[model samples]
Target chain A: MKLDLQTELCRRLNITYPVIQAGMAGGPTTAEMVAGVSNAGGLGKLGAAYMVPDAIRDTVRAIRRLTDRPFGVNLFTVDMTDDLSRVREVQRMLDPLREELGIAHGKEDLRTPNWFAEQFQVLLEEEVPVISTAFGVLPDDAMREAKAAGRTVMTMVTTVEEAKLAEEKGADVLVAQGSDAGGHRGTFDITKHPYGANIGTFSLVPQIVDNVRVPVVAAGGVMDGRGLVAALALGAQGVQLGTRFLTSAESGAHPAYKKALLESTEEDTVITKAFSGRPARGIRNAFIDHVENSGVAPLPFPSQNTATGDIRKEAAAQNDPRYLSLWAGQATRLLTDGDRAEEIVKEIIAQAQELLK
Target chain B: MKLDLQTELCRRLNITYPVIQAGMAGGPTTAEMVAGVSNAGGLGKLGAAYMVPDAIRDTVRAIRRLTDRPFGVNLFTVDMTDDLSRVREVQRMLDPLREELGIAHGKEDLRTPNWFAEQFQVLLEEEVPVISTAFGVLPDDAMREAKAAGRTVMTMVTTVEEAKLAEEKGADVLVAQGSDAGGHRGTFDITKHPYGANIGTFSLVPQIVDNVRVPVVAAGGVMDGRGLVAALALGAQGVQLGTRFLTSAESGAHPAYKKALLESTEEDTVITKAFSGRPARGIRNAFIDHVENSGVAPLPFPSQNTATGDIRKEAAAQNDPRYLSLWAGQATRLLTDGDRAEEIVKEIIAQAQELLK
Candidate 1:
C-alpha cells in the first residue's frame, strides 16, 4: 500500500514520491511544514514572496535550525514594463486608497523598494538547495547562480506554451499549474491570453509533459494521493500542493481561516482578484461578495497588491474575516483541521496505492 | 490541420467517431444538431430528461427521419423517495415566493410518471441503437431488456466507486462526470456522496478504465481537440461533451442563451442548486444571482423542480432572463457561435491526432 511517492518524485526530480509542498508566498507555507515534509522525505518550500533580504536570511536560518533536509525558497521574477509612466499610472491609482486608509497622500518617496535583489541574495547566502519562481521565468543570472550552486530551479506555468518558454529560459522543472490551482496563475502573458481554456491538471499536465522534455511538477487542486496518482498517470514527475497543507497543525494560517477552509463545500469557493489583484481560488465570503458586487476594476499586479497590503494587515490584526486574503485551491474543503502533515501525505500515498492496481 | 475525430472517436467508442451530443432536455439540443452530428459520423443523443413518453417517442422518431445514423436517448433514472411530507416542507420554503410571483399558493401535484416505461416502449418499437441514463442507473429489468434488444447501454458516474457500481449493475460503458461538467451531477446518492472533488476526465478516465473492463467516456470541461487527446492519454475510450455543441448554429439554444454562453469566461460559469434542486453548472446571470441571494431553503429533487417549473416556463416565455435555466458546462466560454458540428468533431480529432505523438 506504500506508494513510494518520495522515491518516484525524487527519481523524477532526480529526488524520492514525487512530493513537493508548493511555495505559497503569503501564508499556509511555514518553516515547520517545509522542514517537517522535507524531513519526512518530501520537499518543502519556503515562501520568500514578501520577505526582505534580511528576513529571507533569518527565515532560512530558522528552517535550518530544525532539520538538515533540503528546502526551497520561492521568488517572484516579475518583468513589468519598465516604462516609468506605467508605474506612475499605478501610483496615481493608489493615492486615493492611501488617503482612505488614513495615510497621508504626499510622502515624497514614490519609488518602490528593490525587495527582489535582497531576497535572491539571501537564498544564495544560505546555499538553499532549491529555488522556484512565479509570474515569469527566473532571470538568466539567477538560473546561472542556482546552477553553479548545484540547486534545482523550478518555474510555475499555467499553459504548455508557458511551459516551453520556461524550459527555454533554463528551468530545471515545470510546475504545470491547472485552472483548479489556487493562488495566482503563473502565466507569462495574462494580457494577451486573458485566461482562456483553464486546463485542469488532468488536461494541462500531460500536454506539458508531452510538449517539454523537462520533468513536470503538477500543481493546483491536488489534495491527496488519488490526485497525486492521477498527476503521475498524466506524466507529471511530481505533485506540488498548497491548500492541503494549509490546515495542517504546522501551517501559519489563522485559526478562523483554517476552520473556514475545513468547513467549506466545493460550492463555497470562487476564483476572485479581490484580495491580491490576482486571480486566486478561495472560500467565498463577505470580501469576495463585495468584490463581485462592487464591480471595481482592480489595479494591475504589484500596485493593487501594495494598495491592499495595509487593508489585509489590518484585517488580520483585527481578526476581520471579510478583509483577509484567503488564498486556497479548489480542494480547500478537503483540508482537515489538527491533522499532521506526515499523516496526510502518507494517507494520500496509501489511498492512491489502493487504487493503482 | 485536418483531424479525423469521427474515425478516432468511432474507434474508441467501439462505434464510429467518438462524438456524443448532449441529451439536453431543454431548448438548445435540437433534432437538427443531433441528426447533423450523427450523419457526420458521430453519436447524437436526444435529451429526453424532461420529456413525457409520447414526446420522447416523437423526438426519437423525428431524429430517425433526419438521419439513418445510430443515435441515443438520455433519461433521468433518479430514485424518487416515496414521501409527500418533503413536498410540503419544500412548499413551505417557497410560500413567500408564491406571493411575490402573484400565485395564491406554491402547490403542485407530486408526480413521477412512468415516463421511462413510455420512452423505453418507444425505443423498443423504433429499435434505437443506444440508451444512456443520468442522475442514476436504470433498473435491472430495463438494462437487461435494453441489452437483450441489442442496444448499447451507458451510464454517468463521478467517482471510481460509482464506476464499480455501474459495472456491477450491467452498465455497458461508463461516462465519468467531472465537477467541471455542466448540468446536474449524475450521482446515485447526492445527499450521501456530494460530488465535490473534480475527478476530471484525465484523472477519472484512467481510474475508471483501470477499475473496470467496460469502455470509459470522459465528460466535463472538454472543449477542444487538446481535451480529446488528453482524455485518450488517460485511458478514456472516448469523450462526451454538451457545452461544445450548445452554441453551434445547428443547436436550438435561445439567442440570449447562446449569446450568454459565447460571452462568458470560465469564471462566469458557476455550479448552483438555485435553478433545479440539484447542482448544475451554468452561466452566472440575474436568475442565479436572485436564487443565490434569496434566503429560501431549496426543496429536494422533483418537488423543488416542480415548484420552480412555472417560473422557468414563464421566464422563457417572456424572455425575462431572470427565470430561465441556463444549463452549460464550465467550458461554456470557449464555445463560439456559428460553430459547425462537423468541424468541431474534426477539430477535436485533428488536435488529438497531433498530440498523440
Candidate 2:
C-alpha cells in the first residue's frame, strides 16, 4: 500500500512528498500552517505578498523555530505602477459597501508605494530556502540572487507561453495555475489575458511539462490524494494545493471565510474581476454581484485591490461571510472540517498511496 | 512492454479499450471514421444530431458494412423552442458575412422542428448497439425504449448536479464534459448556467465519479495516451475525445476546418455564444469577434444557431475557416496531420501502455 510518490521534485526541492502548500497570499497561510505542512513531509510556504518586511521576517523566523524543515516565502513580483484613471470612480463605488461594513468612506488614500524591494531584502537577509512569486516571474537579478543564495525560485503561470517565458527567465520551477485555482490567477500579461488563460489542470499541466525543462507543479482545484495521483499521472512532478489548506485548523483564514468554504459547492465559485481588477475565483456574494451588476469596470489590479481592502477586512471582523472574498477552488465540496495541515497532508499521502496501484 | 489497461468500462461497453470517439455533431463523425475506431477496438459513435432519420439509418448500415464491431449513434435530446426576439437583429448582423461568402442575405428560416422522435425511432428500427444524447438527457420513454432494445444509453453532463440528474433519469453511462471540450458544452440547464458549468476535467471527473453510481467517462481536452492514463488516475472508467478526432483522416470535417485545428494553440480557442445562443468552445474567429464586440445578445439557442447556419455553410463551401465555428479544445497543440482514426487509436493505446508502468 506504500506507493513511492517521490520524483525529481523531492531532490530539487528537498521535500519528502510531492505536495506543496500553495502560497495563498493574504492570511490563509500562517506560520503554524506552513510549519505543520513542512513537518508533515511537504513543502510549507508563507503567503507573504501582503506582509511587510518585518512581519515577513518574523513569520519566517517563527516557521524556522517551529521546525528546521525546508519552508518557502511567496511574494508578488508585481508592477506597482497602478493606473489611477478609474481609482476615484471605483473608490466611490466601494464606499457604500465600506459604510455597510462599518468602515470609513473616502477616508483612505488610494495611492501607496509597494514594498517588494524591502520584502525581497528581508528574505535574502533571513536566508530563506525557497522563494516563489505570483502575478509575474522574478526578475533576472532576483533569480540570480536567489540561486546564488541556494534558494529555489518558483513562479506561477496560467498559460504554456508564460511557463516557457518564466523558464527562460531563469526560474527553477513552474507552477501551472489552472483556471480552477482559487484567489488571483497567475497570468503574466494582464492586458493580453484579461481573464487569464482558462486552461484546465488536466490539459495545462502536461503541455507545460512538455515545453519547459524545469519541473512543473500542478495547481488549481486539486483537493486530495486523488488529485495528487492524477497530477503525477499528467506528468507533473508535484501538486500545489491552495483552497485545501485554507480550511485547515492551522490556517489563518477567518472563521466566517472558513465556514463559507466548508458549506459552498463547486457551482458556487466564479472568476470575477470585481474584487480585484485581476480575476480571482471566489464564492459569489452580495459584494461581487453588486459591483458586477453596476456595469462599471473595476480599476486595474492593485487599484481595485486597494479599493476593496477596508470593506473586506471589516467584513471579516464582523463575521459577515457574504461580504468576504471567500476564495476557494471548485473542489470545495471535498473539504472536511477542522483537520490540521499535518493531518491533511498525511491523509492525502495515504490516500494517494492507496490509489496508485 | 505491453500493459493491461482495460477497466470495468471495457466490460460495460463491451469494447477492448475504453476510448470513446466523441460524437461531434455537424459533419465530423463519418461512418468511415466510426468504423475505423470500432475496428481498432474502441467504441466509435456517429454524430447523428444534425442528420435526418434516413441519414442516421444509412450511416449505421454503412458502418456495419465496414466493421461488425459495435458502434453508436448520437442524437440531440434538445428543446426545439425558439426565442426569436433577437433573430432579426442577429440576421441583419450576419448579412454582411453572408454576402461576403456569396450567399443570400436572408435566405434561411430561423424556426425548425426537431427530429428527436424520428431519430429515436430510426435507432430502434436499425437496432443500433449504442445510443447517446447531448444537450439534454434522453426522455424517460426514450430511455425505456433504448434499454428495452438492449442498447446502452450515454449522456454528457458538465456539472455534478447534471450528472446525478442524468443518472437518476436512467442514463447507462455518463460522459463528464469539462470546459476544455470543443463544440457545445454539455450543461443541462442553460437558464441557470448561461455560460455552462466551467469545471475542468481534473476536478469534474473525480467529483462526478464519487457522487454517481454509474460509470463516468472523462471528456474534454483529452488528446492522447497521457490524457487517457490521467483520466483513469482520476477514477474515470474511460475517456472521450472530440477535437482529437476532428483532424483524423477519416473524419468528415471540412479541409479548412481541419487546417485550423492543426495550427491553433490553446489560447486561440474560447467559449462564445455567438455561433449558438448556448455557449460552445471554438477557435476565435472574426465572426465571433464582431458579434461579441457589438454588444448584442445572440438570439437564444437554436435561433442564433439557425440564423448563422447559412453563413457557416457558405463559408465551408467557400473553403474559408475564419467564418466557420472552428471548434477545438485547449489541447490544439497536441493535434497532428492526417492520421487515420485506426492509427490514432492504436498510437494512443501503444503510447499509454508505455506510460502505465
Candidate 3:
C-alpha cells in the first residue's frame, strides 16, 4: 500500500514528497543534484551561501534548464563584519596549516564581501520558487519582496527561540537543524552560545513543533527511510538531508571528501570552529587537530573561513583529505557510494512506505 | 483503539509495555517510581549505584512490597580506582566550590568503596528480575551468576563498538544512550573519547540497532509518546527514559533540583565534567561556570566525584540549586511540574497508540 506521506509543507513547497535535500554551502550541492531531487519528488536546493550573485543566477538557470519542478536556493543571512583587531593572532594560528599546504599568505587577507545583500537581490531577481536562509532570516523588505514574488521562504533554526524568531519574521517553513547536522550549525547568536547549539534532532523536532505554528523539516543525521518515518512520528512535516546527498551521483564534493564521508563512522565526526569561525560538524582530520590541540580559537565566521579557504582549496587540489574540511554528519556509516538523487529519494519513500504499512 | 506495540524484548522483560524507566544513578529513580512504572505495565528501576548493599536490598524489598510486577536494580560496573596522583590538585581545584558550599575539607578525604561486588551480590541475592549495569557490563562470573539465577541483563552503551562488546559480554538488552541523555554518559572507555560520547539519539539509536543483534532500548531525550513512537520508528524495540522521571511524584530529586529543571530551557543545560570528573549533562550552575572559566581539567571519575561529594550534599541540604548537580536531559522544557510515573507511562503509551493509529 502506498502511504500518504506528503505533508502540508509538501503542498506549500509544491513537492510530491516531504523530503528536502539541505542547501549545504560551497561544494556538494550542485544544480544537477537539486534538479534531480526535484524531479524525484523531493525538494532539491542549491547551497548558495558562499556563491557570488552571478554563480547563484547561473545555478538557478541551470536547475531550471533540467527540471520544471519546484526547487530552492539557500543563503547565509548573517553579517560578515567583525572586529579584526585580533586578525593577526588568528592568522598566526593558521600559519602552520598554510605552510604545510604551500599557500602563500604574508598579509591579513580575507574576503569580507557585501555578498548577503547582493545574494538576496539575485535570489529575488532569479524568481526562485523557494528561498532558504541559514544562520538567520532575510530582512523585512527583502522578505516582503520574496513573499510578494510568490516564493516560499525557509529558515534554519537550532533552538525553539530561533524557531519562534523565524516564524515572527514571516518564514514559510522552519528547518530545525540538529547538532548532528554536517557543516556549519545555524545558531542565530554566537555570543550566547559560544559552545555551539547541540540540541539533538529527537528532542529538537518535537520542541520546535510544540512552540511554533510553522511547519518544520527535521535536518541533521537524517539519511534514510527510518529517519524519515521517525521524523514524521516526532511531528516534523519533512526531513532535510545534508550529508545524505554528499555522496550522491550529482554532488559536487571533492573526491577525497566524498571518500572520507563514505569511510567514516557515526563517532568519527566532531563539531568544531577550526574551519569556520562558526561551529560546524565535520570529519576530524589534521587541520581540526592542530587548531584544537594548540588551544588557539578560530576568528569568528567568514574570518576563519576566509583564512582557511586557500589551504582547503590546495588540499582538495592535491586530493589530501587530512588538510581538507570534510563536512559530514554523524550518520556517515548509513551512506553508500554514488546513488542518484532519484534512487535516494525513492528508496527513502519506499522504505518509509514499507515501515508505515 | 490500542496498538499491539509489544515486541520480543517486551515479552522477555515480562512487561506489557516497552517503556523502561532508566536505572538512573544517584537520586532520580526511587522504589515508588519503579513500582509505579511496573504497575502501569512498564519496567521501573532503582538507582542504587551510590547505595550500600543493605540499602539496595532494602529498596528491592520496598519496591516488591509496593508491586508484584517485575522490577530492576542498577549498579555501576566501572571501577572506582583512578590514578589519584593528581587527586590533591583536583581537590585544590574544587576548593572554591567547597568554600562557597560551606564544606569542611581539611585533607584528601574521599570515599572509595568496593561497592560493585557487594551491590551485584545483593541484586542476585534479592533475585532482581532485571539487572541493568552502566559504564560497562558485569564480570564474566557475575554474568554467569545473573543468567543462572534467571535475571535479564541490560548494559548501557554509547557507541556501536560498545554495543557489540556488551552483547558479546552477555548483555540480554542494550540501552543505546544518546548524547542528549542526562547524567553521566556510559562510554565503555573514556581513553578514546576524552570529550565524552556525544552521538545524538537520532543518529545513535539506528546505528546501534543496525549493528547489534540483541533487543535495543533507545535512551536519552525521550520524554513522551512522541519520543517513544520515534524510537520505535528508528528500529528500537523499547525506550528508556532518565530525566523524564526526574520530575515524577515518586522521584527522590531535591525540590530545588526539580524546580531548576522546571525553569530551564533546552539550551540552559550543558554537558560538563566539573561535577563528577566525568562528562554529565545537567542544568548549568555557578559551580560549572567557575570550573569551566578556570580551565581546570577534572580528576578522573571517582576521584572528581569524591572530591566534590561534600559540596553537592551540602548544596542539597541547603536547598540551593546553584551549587547542586542539576542532572537533566535536553528535553527539560517538555517536562511538567509533577506527574506520577503511572501518568507519565500511561500518557506516553496513549500518545504512541494514537500516533500508531
**Which one wins on lDDT?**
3
User: How does candidate 1 fare on TM-score?
Assistant: 0.62
lDDT by residue (B232-312, candidate 1, tens digit) is 544566778888898887887776677677776544566677766777777777767766676665666665666777766
Write candidate 1's Cα lDDT for A133-160 as tens digits. Answer: 9888888897888888888888999766
Pairs in clash, predicted candidate 2: none
Retained true contacts (fraction), each candidate: 0.03, 0.48, 0.66
lDDT value, residue B110 of candidate 2: 63
Candidate 3 C-alpha lDDT tens digits along B1-357? 112378888899999899999888887888899999999999999989989899888989999999999989888888888657776777777787778777765257566776888899899888899999888988999999999998999999999989999999899999999988999878878888875779999999999999989999999889998898889888899999989999999999999999999998889888888878778899899989988887678878877777777788899899998889999899888897789999999999998888887
Question: Which candidate gets the maximum DockQ versus the true structure?
Answer: 3
* DockQ of model 1 vs. true complex: 0.07
TM-score of chain B of each: 0.89, 0.97, 0.97
Query: Candidate 2, residues B102-191: lDDT per residue as tens digits?
Result: 778764356766888998999999998889989889998999989888999999998889999999999989999988888897888888
**TM values, all candidates:** 0.62, 0.98, 0.97
Ranking by TM-score: 2, 3, 1
How displaced is residue B283 in candidate 1, in Å? 1.7
In terms of lDDT, model 2 sits at: 0.87
Candidate 2 on A131-154: residue-level lDDT in tens? 999988898788888888888999
Q: Which ten-residue region of model 2 chain A has the weakest summed lDDT?
A: A104-113
Please report, as a residue range, the 10-residue window in candidate 2 chain B with the lowest summed lDDT: B1-10
- Stretches of candidate 3 exceeding 4 Å from the true structure: A1-4, B1-4
